[model samples]
Target chain A: MEFILENILNLIGFIVGLTIGILSYIGFKNTGSPTLFRLGIAFLSISVGFFVVWAGYMAEDFVLQKGHIEKWVQTLGIGIQTIGYFFIAFSHSIKSFFPKSRYLRSVGMLPLFLVSAVHIEHILRSVSFILLAYGAIETILSYFEGKKKGTIFVALGLSFLAFGEFLGWYSFVFPESILYYVSISIKIAGLISLFIPISKIPLTKIKFDSEF
Target chain B: MSKINAEARMVTTYRPHMKIIGDILSTTRDDLHSDGGASVTYLIRKANVSHTRISKILSNLVSQGLLEQVNSEGTFRYKISSNGREFLVAYQTFSRFAENFGLVI
Candidate 1:
């Protein structure tokens, strides 16, 4: 029963991320905004990562008994997702300063290197939390500067995601607690928050001329 | 942070020409409409650009049938054409999409 619930949650997260990814991609294509393109890449990575995690979970529950491949699949998913969050943070807070710096972008992969450690999952979760927290802080700072409604939602969504990941990491210390369920629930809420704004983008009214 | 990962680096910061053209047209149309018609000086202020840049963009807009030049009360002013109005609406929709990502279009 719990396995089914986890898979359902992962599916929902994947769908939400995919929706956001497509919206950002369309925006990037229309406006040619590098920021939007980065955001699109981030969300797409998240979607793909979640899909891999879902597959890994299914395999773990149904198939192989503790194989190296299955474990690495889960680790890679988390690593990719962490890279996505890192891009979100960089795009939001530091892109303008180092717009096309190859050097700066390399910092995003530091978490991937840590996957060789014994507690790879915990390390990935902690790194993801940090990246997400950075993004949330940047969004909040932007909200304060502009006082826009959209900014507020983005900030709240990213913050919730960070908090959820933190709780997931905490669950490692207290395996018998309900923190796992709570973490999944909160992460679902975070995905919803991120999904809501982009959901209506496709229906946006435009009066384009035949020439355009 | 010291050693850059070769595969993770962003190579370019290029924005498509169409986007730039849309930005110029939308800014011009919105500025003129809001002001009921505006002088070059007003456009420069509204677009946050230099006078020369505004002049070049306005000429391009006028040539593209997106703007009309008017001589009113001994002052040259610019106004949005019907085509420009439609373009503005399309640009606005694009802006809203970008806004979802907390990006300024």
Candidate 2:
């Protein structure tokens, strides 16, 4: 199980990187319009960032094996993860905060920075979990607001992520290595979140049209 | 209350090619215009529309007098009015513009 998990993360990281690459191409193809062009760049940024995390994680692991190299790798991992988070969050919607940009469609990178910091810093993990908890609750609320499908699934998924982060962080506090698996599980969600939808949209759309 | 409304909303995001819309609306109008009027069921069957969508379209047509409701005992009969004919013609013209521009419906 340990070997499998370790190897698969690397493979999935490549796949995720590929998906983002596809997204970038699609964005560019549609780039006659500014909106799509910006979106393409954002997706590319995120893909590049994820690749960094994949590389940083491996580097940090190697460093941990050496008595003298521990602190540097941890710092490097933290930096890469932080930058990756920035790109991920920036790729999502965040424009509502600015009045002018409210209509412009916001793409803020702030949460990426925040969560990346929280994850590596340990002290801020509680705060990160709290923010995610709030997000999970809001996702539930959105389900009640006329969203016809996937509302519950999304809510449950987000809850899982929140719990995973919270529990992993708790384990980190006590220096229990077992909880690292839980933390790894939380990150692995990108595999499900990123790839499953790309595969299932066709099936879901078919069922949707036939039944509804 | 209408399935068609739900379907319409579903497809609102689809952005179909103008040619497809023209094909669909032409077939629908052909089936509806034959007798100078159409029952909702006949239109639904011909247009491949569900009851809900028929009701939504009828409601709009009635509001604009493009369709008139012939109220009968226990059942309402829907008939295409002159206003509807005009709207159909206008929609056809719009389809032409869409095709020329390579735009989606």
Candidate with top DockQ is 1
Shift of residue A99 alpha carbon in model 2, Å:
15
Best by the lDDT measure? 1
User: Which portions of model 2 miss their true places by more than 4 Å?
Assistant: A1-7, A10-14, A17-21, A28-50, A57-120, A123-159, A201-212, B1-105
Q: Is the docking of candidate 1 incorrect, acceptable, medium or high quality?
A: acceptable
Name the 10 consecutive residues with the lowest summed lDDT in model 2 chain A: A202-211
The number of clashing residue pairs in model 2 is 6
Backbone clashes, each candidate? 0, 6
Clashing pairs for predicted structure model 2, backbone only:
A85-A112, A90-A109, A95-A106, B2-B52, B4-B53, B66-B84
Candidate 1 residue A23 Cα shift, in angstroms, is: 0.8
TM-score for chain A of every candidate model? Answer: 0.80, 0.53
Best-fitting candidate, measured by TM-score? Answer: 1
